[model samples]
Target: MDSTPGVTIDLTVADQDSKRFGSAPSPIKIGAVRMHGWQVHPISVASDQFDGADAYLVKFNYELGTTPDTPEMNWFELGVELREGVVVDAIPHHTQPTQTSVSYIVNDHLNLVPATNGVTPAAHLPATGETIHVFGVGSSGVRWQYWATSDTGVRWGSRVAWLVTLVDQETTHLDLTTIVRFDQRPTLDWNVLPAVTPADLRIELPTATNPRAEVTTQPANGTTVALLPSSPRVFISYTHDNNAHKQLVRDFANLLIKCGLDVRLDQFASPARKDWFLWANDNIDNADFVIIIASPKCLAVGEGKIDRNEHPGMHCELGIMRDRLQGNRRLWEQKLLPVVLPGESLSNIPVFLQPQAMDRYEIDELTEDALGDLLAAIHHGTEDNSRSPVVLMATSARRALADS
Candidate 1:
């Protein structure tokens, strides 16, 4: 005897070509009145030179048995879980619904962005315990796996699930699709679902036989593929002007972390007891790039005008930096970067660094775009080819003083 309320949910997979996706299972009732259906689709895109499958479309037609009084009753979520060796290349944004009876909203708390060519979206890789929400009307835990490899053609698997909230307080969470295997290849033309071409969709026969040989590579006209570079190590040197200023610096560091950079800050290491001088020396020595936050107080310290007893950390760091600059002028000139934050002026930069003559980054706002120049310098040396006169003069003067 079925005591659950009578509700109808017709699930079907449309626009699925037989070559890319296997037979889709019929809609099955999981718990109470919950219904689910699944299909295996490829996660990779194909091109003329290489044989791979492009993105596929799965049409979901959801209809509730009865309209409820509260708005919460209309909540539902669509999620995807990737198996081992599978990584999410791109995902379409669901901020705006295609067609829905009631008003729908996309939860961007995870900051998931639509996949665009040459642009890396946020929340693409979920940490070991992190949950990423691809599309949903309400919130729920969505788990997925991402692994990196150098193989061109790799076996990728994903499970799509749907969760519905019933008015009777009974929630239904079931796998909408089975584990679909596809050859994951690197492609620049990542088209979102519904816009993908049918000709671009085709699965390779005789999938990888050995489990260890998950991905098989096929050379495409001798095309060279480059792996993503490791995260750059950045050390920030800033003055403790005020609480607000400290907070601002902290926020800036966090944003850099979100952008996939290894940022080292004193604030992040304050929890453990440490020798301040050693900490400063180690970070400045090991960092690939040192970001000096330009401010009035920092200028005073750099110019040797500030009292030696104040801001011991800044004083020690500046001393080490000056020594390094004097030891290897050209190398230090490229490694040490001067940065002016919002509401700060270029004149605040230390004179020895040559604020007016050398390249200094101005961050108008704390965003990826605002940090573009700084990031560029850190990744690639300053575009300017001319040598800084101030640096040459300073080095000459130091040599003369040493001789005397």
Candidate 2:
């Protein structure tokens, strides 16, 4: 099947009872191969981080391979998936203006794929399938783990990536856009149902001019379904001891994905699973914000045979992202971020989440004006009241405070 126009017919070695392409070992040192394109911006409704919410948070990516002639050991990985759509509103008059019905539904025989790599191995699931049937509205709902991927030697072969968490009940946030597609069908149609247009949806983010999803009824360019992104979706809690601090936290998450932001890492775990600390806590509990690299052998606790705790695997992954951000709303006690390396200590975190703590971001003192002032304090730190830079001058001074 290597006819190789855009390839996707490997079909796991024509299934002669495949055991990883009959036992992986070729040029396969497999590390750097990436191409991007993603969008899952809804960082806070119940809140997580990245403050910018308009909705429809999930768009795939491309070009995951075909550059790796040692393109710096090939490192590009972005994956995101949310296989649950059809959450409707506008049924109040329902006369079919742009057509919106189905007052109740959820996973109507759900089976669609291509969120991105990783989760495609439940017998390769018909090579990344996409939308067969899903219909719901009114009470609109979907969260049964239909899809998710993007982290495993940073991905290759196929791409559409999704893995952002602060406390996912079915994907919280993940925006990745890296187009190059020669073809594997991801030109996107997904059997219609409100596809594309939110500005040609490729979602890597941050250029903002505000034409990113706003269709009250219809026709600005038509098609609707986007309601997610409050801002602050970052999670990087490392410890493989030291591959130079995991390449300095993966070049500090590729400079916050080149300052558009939407990063997630733990070296993309999943080495055919040996319980990599329970699969890196299922992608660090769907991060809104959690970055801990406070080393001293990760805050030492053992040292004889080499069980030096590493702050109990980052306090058991920040206690499962603070118990799933207290079931969504306490936003993990106001979005956690700590980078206190260089001989650690802000008393080693946890002084009630360390009072707005995001200590001087030490990667031996990195700067781009300290990562754009820590990405503008993670897009204006939590409870983002529509990203208050004074809420658009308090809604344009509410008619001069009600005409004095």
In the order shown, the candidates' Cα RMSDs to the true structure are 22.0, 19.4
Error of 2 at 209 (Å): 31
Lowest lDDT 10-residue stretch of candidate 2 = 190-199
Please, what is the whole-model Cα lDDT of each candidate in the order they appear? 0.44, 0.35
User: Model 2 — TM-score against the truth?
Assistant: 0.25
RMSD of 1: 22.0
Clashing pairs in 1: 37-176, 38-176, 38-177
TM per candidate: 0.43, 0.25
Quick one: how many clashes does candidate 1 have?
A: 3
For candidate 1, give the lDDT: 0.44
What is candidate 2's CA lDDT for residue 330? 62
Error of 2 at 151 (Å): 20
Report the lDDT tens digits of candidate 1 across residue range 1-404.
11223223221222212212333323222111122232222222224211121222121212222222211111122223211111112222221222222211111111122234543322232112122223211111122212222232111222233221101112111112312111112123321111111111111212234111111122223332221232467899998877568667767876675455557776544222347789899999988889999888888888888898877678899889999999999899999999888888898888888888889999999989998888877767533434443233223323332332
Best model per TM-score: 1
